[model samples]
Target: MLDRSSARDEVVRLTRDLVRIRSINPPGDELPAAELLAQRLKGFGFETEVVEVAKNRANVVAVLRGRGDGPALMFNGHLDVVPPGDLSTWSRDPFAGDVADGKIYGRGSSDMKGGVASMSVAGGLLAASGEKMKGDLIITAVSGEESDSIGTRHYVERNTLDGIGGIVIPESTSLELVIAEKGTIWLEVNTYGKTAHSTQLEIGINAIEHMVATLHEIKSKWESIGYAKDPYLSPPTINIATIVGGVKTNSIPDRCTATIDLRPVPSQEHPKIIRAMQEAVDGMKGKLKGFRGEIKVINERLPFATDPSSDFVKMAQALGPSTLGLPLDPPFGVNFFTDAAIFATKRSIPTIILGPGEYDLRRNIYLGHQPNEYVKIENLEKATRFYYELSRSFLK
Candidate 1:
């Protein structure tokens, strides 16, 4: 077995290779990364296939068959990452994939490129050792995670969930296993009104003003929805992410729109959220002049929850305190969403969210989409071992 420190070095090298690909989500130039991973897995004698759902987006799944009787395990991670924002904030080149001061600095280092590396390393190590196991190992590197997660959602909905026992999303877990993730609801609110001159405000309705009122109502009512709670996560959170109104300051804009993102816990019903927004908007119409508005609610994603006592969660937990020398704690819920939600909600497969990165190392904290983004090397190293041991617990 490789020592923890050396194992980290190997993972760092793999992560550097992956981050260098720059598979940013919008463009999702993940073909190279997916092909690279597929080739590596093929070299390891695993059955691999590439599925291209959309332009510039593809998902890769590799399977290493083991003893037929044991349960199969799936290791999943996303190759796509949010774009690196602002160049000046980073100490090193965001795409350089450089290793310095015992840290690998680059975009997608923590959010998930590091995870892809750990999965690759774990699969590769198991192959190199020629280990015999009771069940098969299926590794999937997917795309479009940062966007609507169409790649994963499509795979789950359209394909057969055959020959797979359980799934682990190698998200940043700070060396802990994440067993549950919060669900997401995204809606775009459009407040419509007639345009008028700034001075003659009474002649025409001010849509921007009406929209602002609607937004406030949404904020207030969203809080009062009496959403259910979980002990592990903070109360359900809501944010008015984007707002836009009149093109210029002088005119009373005829239209104003605001985008709202709601992170609902498992207890919150998705349809109820949409209904509440409708009620909020209807109430706003009565309060403002000509309160004509439209609410477009889309299923951004379904909330994902897993039974903590399941064998899969318990099996991963077994390694945390024993072989990996990490604390064993019941998995908690996370406010930020991930692809795992699809497995638990759509497929009825219990999904866990834990990975290697911690809260402090979050890329968004460093303005992930805004600048030179990177993840710590030590953290990636720690996670690689977790993946290895987590994989081994199932077999030889």
Candidate 2:
């Protein structure tokens, strides 16, 4: 029999402890947290490995082995959190791991050291029970999910997923099941020109002006391209994420750069989009004088979806309601992408995103990457139990 109370306490403690560690992503320092998790899993008799992918950036892989016959299940969560933007906006210290009003308040409490702690505790409890499962339980605490998925990409390159049957990403899904997610394409466009005195406007080509024209042409061309609507996800979209131009106000700008974020449905081809962008640049070059522009793909990940009727998805739907005491509503999709976009899509494994924290922006429950982020203690405990039950049933 599983000790639910003990498991809940362990999860709460672990969540608080993990939140206290500063694993902010810009610096991508996850080594301390990775070491802590490795120590915890080793204490539970798990075979654990901590690999440093970069300086102060690391990934932890822990496995509880079972009989060799059954399929393995992998649980993944990131150790890094987005930086707490403005401290004054927060009611408490973001790294204090403060607990009040039934919530654990911290930068990553919801998005999502809470989920990480729950999954770690669930795996620990499973190992403690000595249940003799036929399959292995693997837990990965990775870094760099906030910026680029460097740690996961490194893991994928280093390991093979031949025997791993399924994956679970404990992202903040509010304990709801997510069958699909959008893909990401980050493209950087640069426009170059000759610098001259601002008074001598005729002598210099303004790169900023060229960039404006390029952006307009690109948007028009991209919008003209049609795509079939996806039932699970919203229409594909694009946004100008960042812009950098001009060194000073006195001189004509010599160069300008902008990064575009494109979210695509699973049916859209990444290469085709790249081609379209290049075409837009070519069109601009013909229309504008000295419109020297280049396009570079910074990073990309495919949209991921698991068939609703897949056996693994069906199993999750069947077990979720009973385990979490919430009705398993019709499957839905998330707008944001996850590490699943790489791990699950690359391995062709059935996967689901289900975990604690509220992600519904319509309800104003944006606990992720916002001021005063927190995870309800109750939700943390419930998530731990659900992961435990789901892992046990799947392994059986």
Candidate 3:
């Protein structure tokens, strides 16, 4: 049987090892990382496999079967992290997985690999100890969470949550239990206009100018309407992510496009949200001279919430952190969206997001998708203990 101390050390080492792998997601290649995790899980006596959902993208699934009759439990974490841009801005190598100042520094350290390692170590400990739990304990190291959540979505489509009791998504939650997340809508808006030489300014229809008007209309009329305020989550927000226009300084652009990100609370519906944004873009049709524009949904994911009074949530709260031995604060809400929505909404599995690291306004830490990202070593150990205890409570 592995002792607590050994488990903690193993968690740290495993996290560091995972952080060393460059599993960045724009292209979303997680095969190498998934293979590494699969090997370790197999060594720990867990039934492990790497399933490829897309070319070069894989998810690692490991299960430690229990001896008694009880519902299965699943632990989920993503394998891919956002790309580490501008290496010069970082204090250390983004892929070095260096440990210093009581933290493990790397690209995926805080955003997730730390939590993934903790869950793996926890499952490994259970296997090593040969504990007679009541149900199966499953760990899924998924890909594409940083982008499309295709990995978890693919897994959900293939697997059933019929016997599974609950799911825990170890995203960066600062140890607080997250019961709800916002919905997401990505939009691409395009404006068409006639191109002409700069000298013939009156003859040319400027697409960029039309796009600016569209943006103003969207910000003023579209965002303010639709969607009610959620008591716990934030109000629906809109962000213009990217814009492209004009081919050359001398030519009036014929076409312009902009990408926008819309985050709405649980009360909002995707269809209504899209319609609202589309209305704003279409409003520019006759208002702006020589302007015709259209908006299309690029991507979307629904908001998710689980009843906090569920047996699983209560049990998780009671288990708390193994390190502190103190009661944690009441469950809270997270504004960010996650793949947990897939399991909770699609599979109808009760799910909660619990993990280490805090990157909110209170912390002023930009660990996720930022340079010099890191997760505290102590937090890793604590998270390992928490996952182990939670798994035991649910599965055993």
lDDT of 2 by residue, 71-144 (tens): 99999999999999989999999999999999999999999899999899889889888899989999999999
Deviation in Å, model 2, residue 312 alpha carbon: 1.1
Which window of 10 residues has the lowest lDDT sum in candidate 1? 360-369
Evaluate candidate 2 by giving its C-alpha RMSD to the native, one decimal: 1.8
What value does the lDDT take at residue 286 in candidate 2? 76
Between 2 and 3, whose lDDT is larger? Answer: 2
What's the CA error at residue 293 for candidate 1, in Å?
0.8
Candidate 1 per-residue C-alpha lDDT over 88-160 given as tens digits, one digit per residue, 9 for 90 to 100: 7677787888877776778887778887887777777776667788888888888888887777886788767
Most accurate candidate by lDDT: 2
The alpha-carbon deviation from the true structure for residue 77 of candidate 1, after best TM-score superposition, in angstroms, is 0.6
For candidate 2, the 10 contiguous residues with the lowest summed lDDT are: 358-367
Q: What tens-digit string does per-residue lDDT give for candidate 3 at 141-247?
A: 99999888999999989887778888888888767677888888888989998999978889999989999999988888655666766655777788999999999
lDDT of 1 at 345: 55
Q: lDDT of all the models against the reference?
A: 0.76, 0.88, 0.83
Q: Highest TM-score among the candidates is held by which one?
A: 2
Task: Kindly report which residue pairs in candidate 1 clash with one another.
Answer: 85-370, 85-371, 86-370, 173-355, 173-356, 178-353, 178-354
Task: Give the residue spans of candidate 1 off by over 4 A.
Answer: 1-9, 361-373, 376-378
Model 1 lDDT on a 0 to 1 scale: 0.76
Where is model 2 more than 4 Å wrong at Cα? 361-364
RMSD of each: 2.9, 1.8, 2.2
Model 2, residue pairs in steric clash:
none
Candidate 2 to truth, TM: 0.96
